[model samples]
Target: MNDFTPSRRSFLAGSAAAGASLVIGLNAKGALAAGHDGALVPNPFVKIAPDGTVTVIIKHFEMGQGTTTGLATLVAEEMDADWDALQIEFAPADASKYANTLFGMQGTGGSTAMANSYMQYRQAGAAARAMLMEAASLEWAVRASEITIDKGVVRHGDVSAGFGELVGKVKETAEPPSEPILKEPKDFKLIGQDLLPRKDTPAKTDGTAIFAMDVAPEGAIYAVMARAPRFGGTVASLDDSAALEVPGVSAVKETPKGVVVYATDTWAAMQGRDALSIEWDFSNAEGRSTEEMEAEYAAALDGDGPVARDDAGVAEALETGTAVEAEFDFPFLAHAPMETMNCVVQAKDGKVHIWDGSQFPTVTQMAVGAVTGVGPENTSIETVYAGGSFGRRANMDSDYHVEAAMAAIALGTDQPVKLVWTREDDVRGGYYRPMVKHRVKMAVGADGKLAAWQSDVASKSIFTGTPMEEMIVHDGVDHSTVEGVSDTQYAIPAMKVSVRNMETPVPVLWWRSVGHSHSGYAMEVAMDMAAEAAGADPVAFREELLAGSPRLLGVLKLAAEKAGWGNDLPDGWGRGVAVHPSFNSYVAQVAEVSTDADGRVKLERIVAAVDCGVAVNPDVIRAQVEGAIGYGLSHAMRQKITLDSGEVVQSNFPDYEPLRINDMPKIEVHIVASAEAPTGIGEPGLPPAAPAVANAIFAATGKRIMRLPMVDAGVEFA
Candidate 1:
């Protein structure tokens, strides 16, 4: 991916270098620019030199989302390009050249890349193919309709010419049709098929994946920081005399928030950082703990705040005797990606280069450029595949990158400096999913149906202070905070929802499903309770509420059918179902669970059905659903990050335990086929799992556990 904007001269130069005889005029943007004009183009332009070699530039950063292969498929499909002869390269960070339409930014998130770019990339491919076909038709003196393209070659009867051979003669032609006919889905030979893993699988299996830890630049020193233990607490002072005396330790620098220890390698840096003595500022804590935050959140729910949505007289309805009230609590959660946080940076000759496994490479580049007082053009960001992101890598606080860049400058060495955050640092350093409390009141009519609903959600705004805050938050309501609930498909006569922003010192971010994680739990659990109150089957109850939504009803019916919703299960085992629409996709899940005599609950199976329009790759879609169920179940079962005196208490896997293979459930995924453009699959599957599991637990034990980590509610699993 050449991030550089291509000037006309550079475009011609590049084409010539590839031995392409065609005179290619670049868009007005300079070569390597991310945005072309005002539009984002993450697809790379390929040029075949007269020498027959192909170069492909990719715009989206590759971070294990299979963007590399997905984007490549679009180009190959359109170009009729020879896959074996083409080489792929990374695009540079230039927002002007590669803005994402879904985010209106130059990066990937929200699972919108594939769906958004599906058509644009195909058009790019079709244009290239048209040119080659025309060139072959001209040479063969045959009608263009008689020409066919296959593997980078244009064929007319027995005559054929490679794309490279036709490039020179095809230059300066009018642009191909803007709305070229797309290949029929049935005719797709590559788009929906499983592609051989291209980049990471081999590297990881062979232990050569260049994660941040593996980035060892020449003369690269190591730096470690002793950051504030408590959120928003700055370091008062540091005693680095002993740290400087440690073997291989070179220098110690004081930062605004912490002390940095520089050494020859990571081990030395770790030793020096440990030996350094630092004075803490506990003033920011004010004795606030998780219990205190929980109380504050509960208090806010009772007071007036911002009204996000109001459709009817919810207050009057809730005030009547026919209403059911329930409160659900979700604790703060840590991203806890396996790789932790680390960045390697080098500053030399007014140029900054960085190597990091970040989900937000453009943001990282912009932050580095801003902090170093350099132009964005002067910075280079190289993205490596992250072990896992789950939104942690999308940090607005570029603490790791800033520390490394500053250390490199302070050390006065052209050598790169790698700053690593230990597992403890990563855990204790802020940026957690906001803890949330929901107070819900629903009015049930004598007819056993919901008449009106009122919900008050209290939580620290995930968007209040981040770069994405303005775009995601409006009218004092963070849409990310009420996704599943606000856009619920259920048909209630009236509904009122309000959000009270709880200002807390803890830094929060959008975790995987964002608000859907907790909001889905609260909404679905409430729905299940309503169903039980109505004396109706859960599936039938949901179907009645979702009468008008065909897509929702479709998934709901499919999931229930697959889970054998009405069939009798073994004694003590119960089934629960939940449906949600997010990221343009509708998902429904049914969880089967059993409770032992001693009250231990075990989730045995999960049946998932998704209507994501068209399934570009059914296998990948199923894999995503399975992965989300596993992740969602982990959070539902025991994943939580508790704060003690404003500091995270869970430091590693031992404390924040995720599910293991032994706890794996039998997962069945069904994709509802449609011709509608593909919607997201990455995070949508997650929102329904927790609620489905909770609903199942309620069926098994007749207990409506309102709090998360069912463990917290004393709902133990065997």
Candidate 2:
């Protein structure tokens, strides 16, 4: 038998002792979290057990972004570990154990998982590999440089030993080297491979993967709550006698936001919540509907706002030509992840334990601890796999998690409670992306070039009253509202951008692409309109204007070529295009659209080109591009969350719906080759999707879709 094959059966029988696992860190730059006693904590991300299994504990939560596979590939490539024997585990709640290398806190968001973990995880593998080689060197009594590893086997001349055999020797080593070697990308066997199926796919598909909602702790009780329909409204009074009388229904308590119904099971809790009668007091909130907000925003734009930027010579440029103006209106958006929002908390003996799929579990731990009076140090969070979370689970204040903890505290801590938000509740829930309106006036020179520009953005400040207020909000302006506009890609002689930060009772937050969700649509569609006004081809106009940005220009050319931008379409069909840069990645998209005999719009195809730098997994990249396309199209086509008389108007899927399969377009993704470090891939796909389709519609039928949910513009749906 070969040296490697003979150790297989023997390795399978060995197991690691609980205390023998090797613990190491990459560096002091947020890698090895120091404890209260200034001692090294045990956070073994790459652990080689005696049983020949390699376990990697990750800090970030995976919500369909393929971090599970992408991260595993990074470590395995560096360690030369056996891919078949690799396994993944979620890190437990301990700030000193698994802090994010970038944030110093145990949380995940901002598409920063791969960006931050890329070096740390790989270095961890290299350290482990070096430790194993040192063990093999001692056994063979040879220089460590003489030992080489291949497929989990360490070889020195005629002597050979598997990693499982050397792990015991590794345990005997006093300490690992502070600096370990990392592999060059050219030697990678798994990091860039797209065909390697993810390790979690089979379990997720076979229904064995346990999501947070699927978890059932011992003696768990179910909970359902009724939130005030109106923003800033409160429950004045509630009668829960009828709820208490129901079978399996145990108790009902009044939380700050609503009344929660606790029962023995989920069904009973839901039924009990339905039986309760509550009265809401919304005296302080009024005129919060979409119409009222639009009027307020328009007025704010007419007056002076907080000027974000102002360049000299704008007045002279405008004096040379009359102004061409355009306005774009955007409404509130809901995150609406498929699995909805749910949290399970156990508060007993002055300590709290939580099990949830939170993108920011550290925040959840801190929030629950504070609410339960247990202290952050006393709280423990067990992170579980999430179904999906665009950005809701990582709210600035952990709103949903705090509410769940409050309900659990009401249940006396001894009985664990699983607080759940139903589909209706989640849809009508607060924390939608703030409604916004953009107004821009431009002046062009005689040469058909942009001479002067002025832009005004008005919306509720996402950071004004949140925990991030002190850090982000400045001089009465929220930079997030005008990020894409203030940092316009096109060159102009004179430029100015301003924001009118308004206050509304409605809760708002950062959506999938945050500020770019609105700013990208406004800038892209506005550019298309400007091109048409100049009687120049949209592609040609943008190319000439964006000469300064080569990355964006390259994608524009590539996307146009792939989509046959200048080719004639079937009569009545039209093509539209848009390109944008956000989250340090550049993307360009072109959409082909046509109307059927019934005047219904049909999205035929979408061609997207991206430059996210060094593609980690081409399959995941394509999937994210396509998924974002669908998501953006759904919102632009019909999805909206409206309010009337201070109460939410939409209830469920039938009202606030997703794009059906038939409505989704055939998408082709092309990735530009480059050796640059990887940037974000999750949100950049969505920003340009709506504008590309909208611009195309304008090209086909001289109807400009200034407002979103093209339905509002009286456009018929396919």
Candidate 3:
């Protein structure tokens, strides 16, 4: 055997205890976590047990996105371990080791889970495999270079042993290589395979998956909050005598956000909250209706605000050419995640423990710690499975979590409080996708070529008062406000894109694809209009402008070919195509629609093509694309969060309905295969769905519906 000596990692030197397991972390200088059975406590990503179970610690949240399965594939592929013997768990809130490299924070959003952790998990798995091979080399008196691991078994010629058998000696004699070699794409066994089922699917299917609502501690109490009816409204007076008299009610406490009612269970707490009476003060609240807000936004577009992108000679060029003007008004949209917002908070002995399906755990920990007088380091967070977030749970204010912590503090911190928001609360809740208005004026020269393009966008900034403002906002212009327009890959010459950030008392958040959600719609619809003005086919016009973006063009061509863009459909049906790139992924979708005599649109079918660089899990990518199309179509067809006299108009799904089962069209997703690094797939599929459907409606009927929730524009779905 070769005498191999490894330089001990400083972080793991004195922390290692005599044990029969190995733990490898993503960072060489990370802190030690408490390990099971006095094993090496250092590192936080990969752990090998004495029983041969390879546990991968996932730092991202999985909300029906298959993040767990995608992340675990990296480790299993590099370690050459048996996929069936592997398990996964969520990492605790520790930014030092678990921070996303893209955001410098421990959070999951923007579909950046796989993009950020791909190399980290691979390195972790390689390090563990290196240590195991060295351990087996020493135990069997074989050369480390000659030992090979295949499907969880270590072998040297005829001598063979399982990873569990050699793990006991890894900590005693073997050392992890500082730079472990990784497998190439050609040698990968599980990275691109679709047969390896998702690890979380079985639990979710068998009713064994534990969501935030399933958490029940021994002395846990249920809490429900009754907040003001309007955004920025405050509690002026409160009477809790009737609430206290309700059955199973224990106490009602008033906090800054709202009044919290604690009871023995969820039903009792909801009943108690309903029984309480509170007078709201709307002196500084938002009293403008949707129409008033729309008017103000429309007025803001009349003048230019902060410049996101300014090109010279655009004004002089527009003086002589024909201008095609288009305007769009989008209403505030609710996330309306299925589970609502719920969390379990426990505070005792000046420390706090929070349990939730946290999309932003670091922010939640800091917010809860500040509320309970506990430092962030002392606050512990346990992330569970989320039903759905879409962008609701990752609040900068940590709204629901902070409320739960305050309730625990007010109720004497002896018991845990499980705070739940009813569907009504969720519908009326503040943080919504901001209402936006876009005005695009394109000047075409006599030669039928695009000469000048000026786009003015107005919307409430989602990052103005949040922690992300400093990173995302630039030069007094929130980059998110003009993302899709300012960063368009279309070859438009002499373009000027400006953004006007409007002030609003109502809170706004980053919906699925952030700014691309509305910007993509405005840009795509305007492109279609410009194509008509130029007397060219929509697909041909896009092809002429998209020469600079190969990925975008690739998907557009693929989608058009798959959908038979130029082929004649049924006599009444018309087709439209839209392409958008968001979160580093490019997606194109084509919709087939037929309009009734009254201009009601009936979506016949949809075909989507996505180029997300590399497909980590093809199944997951296809599923996400399908879901995104459905979600996007649902809002575009008939969903809006309107406001009247400062009160939200829609209370439940009836008014703001999701797409009915029978309403969903047949969807087909095609993925482009490439050798580049993998990108996000969760959100890119959404930006094109709405615009494609809108364009299809226009194609079927010669009328253009510029506003959102087409029903309001007198364009209903049959």
Candidate 4:
């Protein structure tokens, strides 16, 4: 696909030619910086064109998450610019300019896109408006304070001019402000509006938006690798005689991961890969089945592990009070995005150029540079729209990108190569959500209230062996393994949480909501059980315990009210509710479900209430919450990645099914009004869904589902 961003086409060209444009740059600390030729250097984040078009550079990748739209709204609202004149472009691989403040790296995950960059982009817009006002003041012989900009036009009393007319003067005379005053929430026009159209919807609906899969360089070749069936197995030997005979096949080479087949096109490459014969070694491969792993994980829960959190007197409280015990099992899961993993790499003259749905451009640049003998400064990445990547594509090791770089280097030619992972490859590929087991024992005090809570969690650690080990692992505990449990919002007086990180060859990574996926399920289900033991309404019990947490209590109350918690349902129908906080956002979900005589569940409706602090875009937030509900239900209902002696059991959507459209429940999202800083909505809406549904099933059938992917627990969802 052709380069969609005006960054390379006009922004850079305008700067080089000193055209009629005003460019404002931001420094590392968000202060104003100079552009090219003693003027403000084009920071690539903000550009004001002579035609009144305002383009904002987005550092986060858009993966059907509406991140592009959310970030652009910040600029348009702060600048008082016309919404139709706004544009968005993905930032290039420059960590110094675009690093995520939360991670100190250039990446987009953990729903931190909006949270971390909210002020940065707002400041960019405010600064641009300041410069434009200053230029208009100079032209009209009025004080800067007397000038005002509204909808791409500057006016001072009777004098009026479009922003396009002041571009030349702003470039020559206006000075960039280090601290630009931002508009308050009350003065906002587009920030909270639900009718504003998304910038990407036009191109996406017209099929003109560039995705990584759509890029095909002039002389690029297609590459397909024949990897080991099981994880940790390497190539022992390969015979490429038949592969070479295949039409359009050029060469077959061996890399650390697998043997690669290079062809003139994807079809020929796939055919050549199938024709090649390879022998695998299982010396260090995972040989155990999922059943065996589950047994081991369950056993680990019996032992006292590293303490993630400890409140006072939890053991004695459990011994003295009435104990309510439960165990929940969650299986490994695949991301299974619509567009599979693919990237194009070109390495020539000690410079590497990559085109991909780059979630972490800084890491990809470094990984590819290391392989191609090109330094970081010589490597460049062009980000494109990704179909979806719940948590894939942001690999800490840059797996697929390095594989393509190695393939390009192995060819020893200038021909660019596009590495493609077929649907089977994408599904069977590892880095799954770690299989986890949670065992909880809750106690009711003499007052008949939730008193003490103790939880033992066992799972493979996602950050222990990766580059994030030093950052995420603390005091022998992988925090990601026990997030929702350790940092729960519920006001449990006496609580103790311990975690055991099981060593395994099966690679694990953070799924949507990370640890909250399983932790929230266990925590909320235990809450329901505790409520029953106390002989209190589930909503009332939670409200009492959550008295200290206003946001959590607020959403829970809102969701209960919206779902008609006290209303009578049909004989077979039941209502269940759960509230959770993750990524600084609180979400509560209430699920209404009914079960047939055969114990098959039909989820009828879901009511969700979220307080993400100052809803930037209510429409996008609603869409995200609705979409998260479906994604969460898909995994809780039917999806899991199991192994039969180290080989993935399910290959595609047929066997590893997603939620069907016919089974989708009626979803209603309600957003709380708040003026606080905006938090993340991407992953927070997901953690509460499964638990609410599970709780609803219990209310309906009087049966507890201890195991996940309800199919395995003899419970099916319709």
Candidate 5:
């Protein structure tokens, strides 16, 4: 066996664990009994048991993003371990043990799990592999390099040892590799391969998946809240006599913002809340309609707002008789995940425990701990599967989680009480995407090259009143609202971008793609307009303007080539293109659309090219791209949430409809292979779709669409 020497520190670390107690148990006669111990490990990603079983604990909650599978891929790749023999489990509430490397909290959002934890998990796998290899080498009396590993077996020519047989001899004497040699792309056997279905897919499809709503502890009660109709409004008084008369109605409590109705079941709680008579104090400031907010935003554009980006001599370029100006309007939007907002909490013995399908568990735990005067460590958060969270589950203040915890504490109930918000409640809830207005002015030189560009955006700051309000905004300009506009790819000599943060009584939060959603639309549409004014094809014009950006130009050319950009189409069909670079990745899209005789818009196909660099799983990346296209088309065609006197006009699917199957277009995705590090894919596909469709609309009808929900503006597809 090779002499595997250990450092003094490693030996001392192992010696310190000599007093640790190990427990082993068996269920029936031969059935395996799950082991549980109070002792916690710092890196709980993997645990080796005495019985030859390997358990991998995942910290992030899975919500259809395939995080569990992706994390496992990282572990398996570095460990050179047998994937079929590994067992996966969810980690317990231990923030210190599994702190997020990116945000320093135990949560999942921003499409960061795979990209941030890739190396960390790989190192974990390498550590375990080293220990196992050393043990096997010792047993066989051969050098570690002579022992080849495959399918959980270490072999030396005629001799072989299973990982289970070597576990007892494999002392934990190996240190994590500081710079482990990562596997080459060509050597990846399972990462990009389409393996079997995900571990949770069957359970989810069969309705056996345990979401927060399905988590009902024994003797648990239910509660429904009647929040203020207008945000920031408070409840004056509640007449609970009618609610008490209902069968199974238990009690009603008045909270800071509203009244909570407690009952035996969810139906009873909802019915009791409906029966209660409550008066709201909205006299301080009546809520304004969406139209009023849009007008205010439009008026704010005329004022001198904070300049996010300004180049020298933009005014002189505008006066050079080559300037073009246009305006774009983006409406407010809702997350509208499949599962509504819900949280189950139980507060007792100076401690609080919560089971929630939240994206920001650490944030929720901290918020609950601070409000109830409990220690942060004492607050336990159990994450469940979220049906969907497009940045909705990671609210800045943990509004839903705090409200649920407060309700449970106020009730003083030993049983866990779940607070469920109805679909209507979710729709009218405070947080929403801010309505924005964009004014863009650009100049093209005599050579048909982009010379100067100017843009001003007016919108309510999403972070103004949140925890990150102070960190992201400087001099009254919210950087989130002008991200894509300020960092555009064109090689303009002079440019200026301003953002006006308009104050609104309504609450606003981050939606999918965040500021890039509106900024990309404005930028791309403005580019298309400039191209049209210069009497050039959109694809060729963008290529000319992108002379300084080879990466963006490459993707644009690929997308155009894939979509047959220069080829002729049907008489009524037209093509449009858009490109956006965000989150360190570049994406380009070409949309083919046609309008029927009745003016109905029909999106025939979409060609997307992405340069995200070395996709770990190309199929999944393509799926995300297709999904983004569908979502973008929904918003472009008919998805919007309007308000009338602080009340949401569209409540359900009948009005706030998503894209139907017939409305979906055929999508083709192309990935540009590179040796560079991988970038994000979840949100990169979103920014290009809206402008591509809008540009196509202009091509069909010779009309410029400045507003969203194209159907509302008499935009016909034919």
Candidate 6:
């Protein structure tokens, strides 16, 4: 990634040498800052070289979301920058320069990369194009209006100049206009166009993508941390004599939390780690056993908790009417990204450099700097393409990266180290989606209309003790546990949603779609139960309840139509539908399933419809939907993290199963055409998927499954 951004600011072009190339830096507001020498410090987001090469510095990590290419399209569309001239690079860690507008930090999560940076990146390109026009106006002595730029060229009557030739006019001395003209959607050239291939795909296919594990800085040593078997357990004491004698092993250092083995390669490091033995300590173990935690949640559900939403008539309606109640138990789920946690760190002269596939670069920089005693400003972080994140990489604790920095500090600067976690370690690592239980009770009237709904969610709070506790949690209630239920789309007459934020020593972090992961399954499947009791078609029932939200209704209708809702199927096969809105996007899903004679539920197909507004790249949209389906299905089927005596029982894929590619159901995605601004597409497709399958299983066998790892209810593929 040749670091240059001449588009967002006045870009300087030159060779790699600091003295050879012109340098400029800018602040987060797109204004230039002064370098150490008092010269102009450039804050470059895009670079246009004299050779006509356009490079976009991606602020968000490409965590298999296609955001890298999607973002590039926004810039190219607005600037009329030639797609053939485009390239991409990871932005350096500088929160003041690349803070995600949604979070005021340099990171990518909450499915906000495209949503938050949508207008920001567009403005960058629009401003860059304006800067070029200002330069062309001066170079040709023509009014800025007379200077028409199109397809990488600026033309004034017969006098025309290619962007490469005119870009130099925006020299190190040229100043960009205070205000830049922007293009309307109708005038878009590349946005919403699907012909262009994803910029990341070619590199990924060619095996040239730069993932954190692939980064091997000069003289880099591989490290494997022998982390505590129990959450929050420390290193206690280590006997590394055997580890140090291992072949290629350099050092066995103790970090604040773990023992790090430094070796020539990952295998050597692992071997060294395996050879080490230590005094085991569980006296400081933070978590109780999974059984005890589940009992606590169950008790909390039966007791009282914080009320997130309440409406009149709930008690009166539900007390007098026939009702259906179900208790759903959802286990804690590990993120289990295909690429395990890894970070490369090097420290020198009170300055630190970090290379990681981090979802939070600003946090990573600060955390790593703080641990290394270098401070945030002295840390340089390069966000690399992540193999897979879901939500594992975006931790409030900065867990993995911080441990890497600790190891680097122990190794004593100058020894660049790559901290790697094997799949076993990652699976056993904490910070899973909180262990939760949902007790939902819904009542319907004789008129076939919904009368009342009440939901109680008991779970470990993802925000409880973290730095974000005060900002989000209120009055003993955590929104993450009740998000989908509190703001449910159903138009019930009375509703009450509450959460019991059961304190658990088990670490918890936001998984894909956060609260919607469990709440979606609970609410959507419970609606199906209500529909069954009312003897109404599921789709029609949802339609009646969603009169206030036409967008969600529209998606539901679309999915139903695409799936042939009323069509007959073979014996033992049934169709089930579900709809939910989260992350500002509406999604509806239809699952086709069949129960085998042996009582295994096999999902045949899924029809998903989404209204995410303007589709920047339709291919990426479909990919996201399909990927979300796979991920959601994995959890719904049989993915769970269990602990015995405060230790994770599941170690790797063998036990903590991920949905295999061969087992994935056929998914058909339909994107609703809309001219509105784009919303989130990343996690919106997941929430509706699980309940759709669960509902389909219910339709097939008349069984009401109200628990996660629906396989627990005897569901699986042949």
User: In model 2, which range of ten residues has the least summed lDDT?
Assistant: 1-10
Clashing pairs in 5: 1-141, 595-717, 595-718, 596-718, 599-716, 599-717, 600-717, 601-717
lDDT of 4: 0.85
Better of 3 and 6 by lDDT: 3
List, residue by residue over 1-718, the lDDT tens digit for candidate 4.
1101122232222223222222233433323333333333224467777776777888888999998998889888888989887788898877666777676667899989888888877877887788788778878889989888789888999889886677767644335566779998889999999967988999999999999999999999999989899998988889999999999999999987688899999999999999998999989999889999999998888887899899998989999999999999999999889999999999888799999999987767666766677866799998999999899888776788888888888888787899999989988974799999999999999898988999999999998866667678888889999998888878898999999889878878889889998898899988999999999999999999899999999999999999999999999888899999999999999999998887679999999999998888999999999999999999999999999999899899998899999878999999999988889999999989998998899999997778888888888765
Candidate 2 at 195: error in angstroms?
Answer: 2.1
Per residue, candidate 5 scores C-alpha lDDT tens digits across 419-489 of 99888888776477888899999887787777789998998888665545556787777888998888788
lDDT of every predicted structure (CA atoms): 0.76, 0.79, 0.84, 0.85, 0.76, 0.81
Q: What pairs collide in candidate 6?
A: 5-46, 6-11, 6-46, 24-41, 24-42, 25-41, 25-42, 25-43, 26-42, 26-43
Ten-residue segment with the worst summed lDDT in candidate 4?
A: 1-10
lDDT digits (tens) for residues 1-718 of candidate 6: 1111112111111111222211122423424422222322223566666665667878888989988899899878877888876888888776656777666567798888888777777776776777777778888898988878777887888988776676556655555443456788889878877657889988899998889888988899889989788886766678999999999999988777688899999999999999999876767676678788888888888888889989999998898777988899999999998888998888888788888887887666666766777766788877788888888998766888788888887887577889999999988875789888999888889898789999988887887766567667988888888988988878888999888877655678999999999999999988998898898999999999999899999999999999999999999997889898989999999999977888777789999999998898889999999999999999998899988888899999889988987768899999999987899999999999999988888888888787778777766666
TM-score for each candidate, following the candidate numbering = 0.91, 0.93, 0.94, 0.94, 0.91, 0.93
Off by over 4 Å in 1: 1-56, 82-87, 161-181, 194-200, 207-209
Choose 2 or 4, whichever is better by lDDT. 4
Residue ranges of candidate 3 with Cα displaced over 4 Å: 1-35, 38-42, 596-599
Across 1-718, the per-residue lDDT of candidate 2 in tens digits comes to: 0001112222112111211222344334434333222322213676676666777787777888788877787778877888877888888776565666555456777667777777777777887787778777777789998888877788988888887777666533235556678888788787777677786798899999888899898899889888888877778888999999999999999877578898889899999988999888888765467788789899999898888889998778777765678898888889888888888888888888888886876556666666777866788888888988888887756777777788887666687789888888888874788899999878877777777888889998987765456556778878778888888788877888999988888878888888999899988888877776677899999999889999999999999999999999997788999999988889999999998787678999999999988777778888888988898988999988887877889988899888999999999999988678788888889999999999888877778888888898788878
> For candidate 5, what is the TM-score?
0.91
Write candidate 3's Cα lDDT for 1-718 as tens digits. Answer: 1111112231122122212122234334323322475343224678777777788888898888889999899888988989888889998887766776676667899989988788877887887788778778778888889988889998899899887776667554334565789998999889878667998999999999999989999899999999889998889999999999999999999887789999999999999988998999999999999889889998988976999998987897788788899999888999988888999999988889998999987677667777777867678899999999889998777888888988888788668999999888988975799999999889888888788899999999998766567678988789999988998989998899998899878989999898999999999999999888888899999998999899999999999999999998776678989999998889999999987777567888899999987787888888999999988888888889999998899989999899999779899999998888889888999999999988888888877778998888888688
TM-score of 4: 0.94
lDDT of 1 by residue, 72-138 (tens): 6777777777766665666666555455555544566787767776776666666567656776777
